[model samples]
Target: MPQAEVDTPLDNAAVEARRAAARAVQTAFRNSGVHAMLEVATTRAAPAVSVTIPLGGTSGSPFLGGTGLPLPDGAGPLQQLLEHHDIHAQVTVIELGPDPALLVALTTGDDALRLAALVIERRSDAHDAALRLSGVFADLGITEDHIYVADGAVQVGDINVQDAITLYDVLTGQRNDAAELDLGDRWDPRTWRDVEKLAELMGPVVSKAAGEPLDCIPHPACRTCISSRPHRITLGSASPQQVLLLADAISSANSSSTSGVSPPTG
Candidate 1:
């Protein structure tokens, strides 16, 4: 018959129906967790955290409720879904959009997400690698059976619980002023090697104390201790290639969260 209304004209009633449908969909996405994650993932180079199709998340996807969320094989969810899954993890609070407008927008747009970045600041251990080592020693449990000096490296003869603790404090700055130390301007191989070496030296002490091997997060301290640096890793996706950041590298890498003019944040 007559191709049934392929080019139907819109009347006043039709226009109202269109508006209502559009409004409903918008309302569903507004202030939703999926929307919030989408907003943040757009800021980052990665969007897998927000989407389900290989790398595409819908604003109304039920997976956000921890029902059918697809966590990649190796890469886990990027801190945004931690609370949704009832997972307790350390989180770094972040503004949703550009400041001034950032806070206002998140507050008005998606108060449910609350906007934070939960990064891996710690490994799987009783406490943070350094903190655990430091605490064990401070508790007065370990002792050093002997001391060995080779190539200017101090080696414990037989680390008891207390001495292991001492080493962690000495290296990780648990008992020392670590925050004052710097990580240098650039993280060259030499710097990384030095940091690695220091961590290796310090790792054993703490391990003996805690009775397990451990490495602390933001190991920039390991570099400072070994290389005697004074420059911290200025991170942030928009941070300068080499900025003398007053804050930690984790803060610097959030280039998307930066104010202005800075480039290459995280």
Candidate 2:
């Protein structure tokens, strides 16, 4: 009978090397302004990490008047909209899988009913509201192809890193283009793994930088409707530095066999 093959356990040196690698990855994430928690691999799952980046917004209520809304020194489009149109809303950056999308929660009324009536009645008020909302998004650097309106919300998908950074600056009173990071040319990820990892890291960072949450109004009907569906946000951009760091970490972790360094396997 052939002998059963057994996996060799990592030596102490190999184990220490893996630990150092993990610490390096964690430090890199921290330097990029993201908080990450590393999860040791289990029998049923691979090693993973969860991150929390600064997303500026009201924590309790996702409304402008609510606590923790980072108002800019100058009035941006969102502020302008509230001051001029009296449209109470919330703006948040969210992650829909590997994509980053923008969510604009319109006024807390029966938006579905109002929008439906506008289609039939052809009322100028509703039409004007839609136009104004579109303009607001446009002023925020959202293009037409990325915009979608449904269920009383406006979602802008496929936003680049610059767009998110600009929004963050507007909300946090930071200098625009402070990082000088233009990720447009490097936006296309080399692999799905890279895409997924970038999504995981960038989502929280961008969202925190923007500081907003998707606070839907507490209308019974609307709440039910919202609960019935899943919420999604898409991010379409990542910095080259971020990508390179992530790639290095992933490569090191995955090449454990060749490097004789076992990854965290709990």
Candidate 3:
């Protein structure tokens, strides 16, 4: 005989509550301009949503204030939205300055890169709420080999905490080697904002290397962007010697295409 279905009053109420929460989150996404990304992410069973909204220009932080429960700084509203409604899906937020190309990459890339990108974004010191966010991918069982940087000419495969640190060392070491490294002609057409965007894209790799617990601090070059660490390091603030080193590191990354190195995996 087939098993009889059981419907408890509590179960029914819980289901209704979850549906309601999903609707509320959806509404927020639509109104906040995050709807497009949400729709794309939701199409799959395990979705990785990546979107870039202007800083200090949105109604509330992507993930606004939640019940007394804590939230990471810059964490999108998706986390609380999911937990509030008892939704069991995995949702991670990545913060990047306005760059249409990044949004495109996030949406089109494979799951591993998407996940790595999120890990990279989460490093920004802008989000100061909790240490609760680190290891999110690992906790979810996403291994290091799964994460990588796929931009042209720059391929950092299997980017994990240690690999991120190594990248940071490589750049910083290069910075120290030359004080006034040229960014090359390719970078001539770009503005400082564009340079900042490149820093943001690469910030995860460097920040993860330097910050304890694998978090990232914004490059000193991006001093104007909304950030929690005002006293953070920047090429401007770096000592004469340090300034040269910082420049060389950035120049190397900017100039090299298809020449990124990945640390040896155990």
Candidate 4:
């Protein structure tokens, strides 16, 4: 008969080191002012933190065409109609998980705030758009409570710091997969291309929001929010000294986001 295996307790120093690392990451994110979510890794997994940074920007014209496909035409009917009504619209498409979701930010020149009323009108065509948008959230397994819409932005996703770091590691060739994070097989690193695209699209927006250029690095030492440039440092490429310098320079910035906003129920 085989004897059962027993777990070895972590040394006091090792335990303290782990606690210190966790606290450092949390404090860095808190001081940086960007929106981030913290999740405790499972006991069997390496202790890690995941962060998600939402990104959005203005669209000059309608993104979708008559057939519901994206079009590059600026003279589209929707654009003309919106222009006629003096509404300024900004649209961003983001894929944090599997499916892409549309975020439409609308503003009007008039002081009456007709565009705001249109967003809330249940009987209008906006209701159909809301349902379609809601379906994207459903596909991503996001609950209504986690959805936030305010200040011309719609933010979805649980926004885990560990997951973001893992994905960044995988993207930058620092790791093959997030297996050490124990996020399960469903959290496939291969399918995170959309996430990369989202980061690329929103990198400028995040930089503007942070009031400085930022880079996406897996290590917690870099306090900047997630944004990438051609010369951005990765965990696989940065030296300990460089990482420390980045931590100091990036820590000077602040970030913020709206929370507890009610999601529209259509």
Candidate 5:
């Protein structure tokens, strides 16, 4: 008698591979120290699939959400899943430090004075730091932007002592305006297309109070402070990075809602 038909070895391998990749992504997330959430989806008609991973939380300054993890460990497996299914996947990330707008305000012209005030407001303990910063800024007869322009090497007083260190740390925190991506090693034509589509969608909706629009979502509470463009997540409108930032804001807001954390004052 003819042997009963069974699943092909190739099919079995593919299933096993998908499972392994998913497991790897989960493991990576756990080890990455980033508080993030993941979602998986498969589109109709094309049978294409995708994964959405949002990373970050509000551990640093409020009103400012930092750029999330650099290249998360889950990226490799996430990329594999994208290629295996010949579909799209987005790793939405949350910045873990200060908000983009705060950084902008501090690094720009007089915005640093406003940010310094806000910093003191948020963290009353920072008042002394603010005072010291003011003295240094006043003595140098320069704006925070000038200090940043000088690469934090400008001397205000006692060039080799504690004053410089304090100024450096405070200024350095605000001067950071770098962008981070998680495209991984397996991106192909499809991934690039997806990313470009996301960028187009996100450009108009995201908002930044000071500099260019942040490529991420803003927290609902942050709406009061940050000036964004309506905060809508129109598919293909926002890049994966923007969505990730939005996700971080959403998560932080949710957590705050539950934890009784106070919202930003100004």
Candidate 6:
């Protein structure tokens, strides 16, 4: 026996139901809060929603100064400085934003050459400093086992205060003939920035080995480190000072959403 076949089309009700579901999802997504910070530790591209911020989007927020925060010396002159430094320095480009704001991240040579540091742009100073410190163990030379340069997607693995302790132990070792040394110190903006903890720790020892003072300021290489420090603080909530300032900026940027905020009256 042959069965009768039935054809069915969605009624207006079904279409409306589907539309309602989609709208609900869209509304929920729009209202979601995303931290405006990008984590470079991972090799993934930042989300389009965060990147497509308008000139007035993330800029006009009181946090970014109603049109983006000013670099210490501003962008124009800084560009000239960075370009000049790049000529003889180990500086390179890292990330560039839609508005063409350059995100220059740098590392020294010793710090740069490692596969872990390969994830982003590194300044030669770091590598040099790391090597200069490593020079104390120059007898070891660059071994395939100790120092490795990695390519493709590589994870930094677990990094913590304990890691610094391990390096610290190596630095304090009496042998000093060891193949690798870990020199990391405090996580403070007062001296080095994000990637510099180990460098900072190892820096002083290397400086002393090189007969230079830890405070002995080298000729300035890149202002990129200093420029990013504030941004780091702003994002990490590491420093209360930056948090207050950024919170104020966020408040101002989103003043419309903050009904309880009292506007300054002239």
lDDT of 2 by residue, 1-266 (tens): 99986545555664454445445544433322223343322221222222222234321112222221233333254345443445443444555455333343433223212322322232222223333433444555555224432222333344443444443344333433334432333233322233333344445444443234322111111233434422222533323333233224334443553465654422
Lowest summed lDDT across 10 adjacent residues in model 6 is found at 229-238
Q: How many backbone clashes does candidate 3 have?
A: 11
Which of the predicted structures, 5 or 6, would earn the higher TM-score when compared with the native?
5
Candidate 1, residues 116-175, lDDT tens digits: the string is 212122111211222222233334433223322222222223342223333344334343
Which candidate has the highest TM-score of all?
Answer: 2
Query: What lDDT tens digits, residue by residue, belong to model 6 across residues 162-260?
Result: 332333333344233222423233233343333344444444543333233332111111355534322111011112222233224323423422454
Clashes of each: 30, 16, 11, 9, 20, 14
Which is the leading candidate under lDDT? 2
lDDT of 4 by residue, 1-266 (tens): 99987545556665554445445534433322223333333232332322232322312111232222233332354344445556554444546455343433332122113332322231222223223333433433333312222222232233333434332332233333333443232233433443344345334433332344544332211223333211121222222233233233222211100232322211
Error of 5 at 127 (Å): 32
In order, what lDDT does every prediction score? 0.30, 0.35, 0.32, 0.33, 0.29, 0.28
Cα lDDT for residue 141, model 4? 36
Sliding window of 10 residues with minimal summed lDDT for model 2: 213-222
Candidate 5, position 63, lDDT = 18
Which stretches in model 5 have alpha-carbon errors above 4 Å?
1-12, 36-50, 59-266
lDDT of 5 by residue, 1-266 (tens): 89985433334544454444444443333322222232222222211122233333332212122222223443454334333443343332334344211111011112222322333333322223223333434443323311110111111122211222222223223121211322231112223333333344333332321123543221111234324211121122223333344334434433454566633312
> Which runs in model 3 stand beyond 4 Å of their true positions?
1-26, 30-36, 41-55, 66-71, 74-81, 98-266
What does the lDDT read for residue 191 in candidate 6? 35
Regions more than 4 Å wrong, model 1: 1-37, 40-197, 215-266
**lDDT order of candidates, top first:** 2, 4, 3, 1, 5, 6
Q: Which 10 consecutive positions of candidate 3 have the poorest summed lDDT?
A: 147-156
**Cα RMSD (angstroms) for every candidate in the order listed:** 19.7, 27.3, 18.7, 26.7, 24.7, 24.5
Per-residue accuracy of model 3 over 1-266 as CA lDDT, tens digit each: 99986433334544354334334444433332222332233332222334333334332333332221134343444455434544333444444444211121132223323333333333322121111111222332323422211111111223332333334444444332222222222223223343344334445544333232222332322334424221121211112222233334334543442255533211
